[model samples]
Target: MSKGHDFLITVKAPGKLYIAGEYAVVETGYPAILVALNQFVTVTVEESNDYGTINSQQYKENSLYWKREGNNMVFDNRDNPFHYILSAVHLAESYAQSLNKTMKCYHLNIDSDLDSPDGKKYGLGSSAAVTVATVKALCRFYDLPITNDILFKLSAIAHLDIQGNGSLGDIAASVYGGWIAYRSFDREWLKKARNTFTLNKLISIEWPQLNIELLTPPENLELLIGWTGSPASTSHLVDAVGLEKAEKRSSYQEFLDLSKNCLFKMIDGFHNHSIEIIQKEIRINRELLQHLGKISNVEIETPLLQKLCETAENANGAAKTSGAGGGDCGIVVINKKYATSSLIKEWKKNGICPLNLHVHQIND
Candidate 1:
């Protein structure tokens, strides 16, 4: 964390998935199990003389530059694909300024291995990963503390400002980077505390009692992830479900309770590599997704997703839509005894792309 030196700072944060508990986690502070993946979004910061610039392949523009306006770095162009990066920079600079520190102008380069070869997002928490990486890299470039507690909180607050409402399990997974079980922070509480972010208040205010735990996958646990050739807007789906939760209170609560149970079981199954427990829980979880979809009148499991799940079931393995579903990646896990070559081939024949993914570890 030495300052007054010219150096390039790069930080990579891994993408993540909610193995279970999606809708329920948004209810203030509910538990969800999220696993960080090998795919990552990385941010690199280097010193510049006049103004700051950011470059990324994800954006159609591909290059973004900003100049400081008084005490802020305002982008030359406001609407772009790289708002996550800009938001991170704004929050970090604001946070640092609050502590009587200032940042240097730098060229920020953002890149990711989180996309398929064809450049489709697989619903792997790309926004969350990018935000975490950007904030962490900026913190390092400016010689700020690189602790998980600091990084996670900064990234979560910045991202929440954009999305308005999210469980933010993705932020935890990217910061911690592993198979983590997370409970949402009290959104209501954060709303009350947003405008009072002095260092003393940030220190004294207890963070939402988040329950995040690392778990080891069963030694024999084998997982296969595949994309349905379509991406889902998690925020959009969450909003739809939120509306339904308000409209149909009793049924939504029932869905929430069932999802909570399934998440706990999946965590236990992963701990012991119990195929029976894992497989059973995944089926129940899928049913819960379908039920929610029905009640919310949203397509949780797309036709392609349903086909993939059905194929996995016929192969005697467990498969379900991961993340926000609708149209994104589906995960299948089974005991090593089952052969998956044919199943994978079936998935491809049906237009699903298999992803070479694994659980990622925390970056040291």
Candidate 2:
């Protein structure tokens, strides 16, 4: 890809589900399996004559400017919510300068479908998706090749730079656009780079100890998502878990080991397409999550979610809350014959809206 005249670029990135490994992944650095949803956060970019501006109808703003110091951005006066978008622009511009090319200032617009008709977010990793989409839009605007590894690096850094949490499993799934088994980046190494390296060096450096593997789940595997009609703050849940881990190290470590074992078995089951293996391992994973919630005093599974999971299990499927899990959604997995009539009825009776979400397949 090569830069030329000014052009408008629109990039869409899929939101992600934390299918397995949430809090444990942050502290223990174990692999987290995530699935990209069909829903997306969209970002549009093109050349602008004035100082850079970022807009978002969904975010209810316009003309969020990108002001900068020598290399870093001046985020003090501008709005805080668009920090991810601003970070992406700075990173891309810095890299372009590193290549001895000047980056033209651009206008950026952001949008997402992870929200409800009434404007409630469903905890679908919209921040991560937007970060990835921002990078994609900027790269395409500047005609940069968005290789998988490079995309991961830019998106992960942008997300982490603003949010200050997340294992970047969501970033990986959003960038890769499919199901993936991802391990967290080595933060010590990345932290060093963050402190000293220029944005140019950050983009060119070879990423060490980062692992991302594409996964192909069985064709007969089925997933059902039920929205709990409640919005959750993932940051709050993550912080609570972090504090609990620090206070109760041994207990947190025990839960981490158990969940890691469950995730490995689940991955193996996916590879072999063994229904029994997947079912048993998923059930074990659910129980361990419950144990974690109790020890940490975080409501990993709300009552509605528990009802949803229990109902699915009664219908011979395994289920659990998909993410940080205060009340966003729960996921159920089963065979192709997952026409669980009783489970569906129970979910409806409990006020959970069955969402029309499914696993996204990456395009070749």
Candidate 3:
């Protein structure tokens, strides 16, 4: 444990899910609305003595140390689980210097709620959430001007370094904090357009609140389950898909297009607040992900996951594995009336765990 110092900054970054449009958003430039789930990565920074220390509770055995080199901060990677934090802090320090301010060294303590206490599935956007939190804390610590756009870009850049290939949607949702319609293709265009709209004008904007229910599955749900067992690195997966397309795999192109269409339909459903439409769109999107080679492995679509979907379908609800899908978590949207007792019993009987998530608006 490290002693606290002069200034302390805390930031909470949210997890995200791409409800629609899997692989297509990267190529065709469509907009995807990623919902910010309640799960978060929290970072707390406190200024220490001249020598900076970075302590993280998330990985109990690891810590980070940084030494100021000229105007840059250099760190050793052996003890750090989060190198991106160092990069973000350096960037924040540089930005502070440009504004004629001195950047203070600090001891940082980070704790994450990314994994459930019971050791359940790893949800989507944990890495992105960490990146966002680190950048947010560093900005506050350095007293840098952090606008919504600047925060979004910095988090996205840090995430790209970690995940290799990421749609800026997750970082944007975490930074912006709500149900956001993120168009990476026209992100700059949207930002410029948003600038022209005044608060009075923005007041007329209609953003619908989605009805989201998080559940824990019953033990019987595990009967048909198979764990992909191995974790699929997101960067490697996306790069493989991209290379296939570049090599002129016509099927890959078609899969990408279908994925984009499915995403559009899902967003339209969300905008219209049509649950039936959204359900159908999710099924279509999942199928497209399977076609795109994103969900090919058995671990990606565990037997338990398939059974849950089947059971939900039989019970008038629809479920699918969300996020990067390889042995992480799954999301189910069922009739609100049946979400609690019966469905939960079925899930628990099968040994599947469910998480409770609340969807809320993000403040800029």
Query: lDDT of each model, Cα atoms only?
Result: 0.83, 0.80, 0.61
Candidate 2 TM-score over all chains jointly: 0.92
Clashing pairs in 1: none
TM-score ranking from best to worst?
A: 1, 2, 3
lDDT of 1 by residue, 280-360 (tens): 988898899899999999999999999999999899888889988999989887888889999999999999998889889
- lDDT value, residue 25 of candidate 2: 75
Compute the lDDT for candidate 2.
0.80
User: Mind giving the per-residue lDDT tens digits that candidate 2 earns over 255-294?
Assistant: 8899888888888987897877877877887788889999
Global CA lDDT computed for model 1: 0.83
Choose 1 or 3, whichever is better by lDDT: 1
TM-score of each: 0.93, 0.92, 0.79
Candidate 1, superposed: residue stretches over 4 Å from native:
1-6, 60-62, 197-200, 203-205
Clashes by residue pair, model 2: none
- Per TM-score, the best of the predicted structures is 1
Give stretches of model 2 more than 4 Å off. Answer: 1-6, 66-77, 196-201, 204-208
By TM-score, is 2 or 3 better? 2
Model 3 clash number: 25
Better of 2 and 3 by lDDT: 2
Please write out the lDDT profile of model 3 over residues 1-364, one tens digit for every residue: 2334646788888877665555565542655556677778889888866767777666666777776666666676555566666656654565567667765667877777766655434555677777788888887877777776677656654565555565667777787765665656333443453477642232234222211222222222221112223334555556666776766667776776676677667666666666676678767776776666543332345566676666666766656655556555556655454545566667777766555666545554
Judged by whole-model lDDT over C-alpha atoms, candidate 3 comes out at 0.61
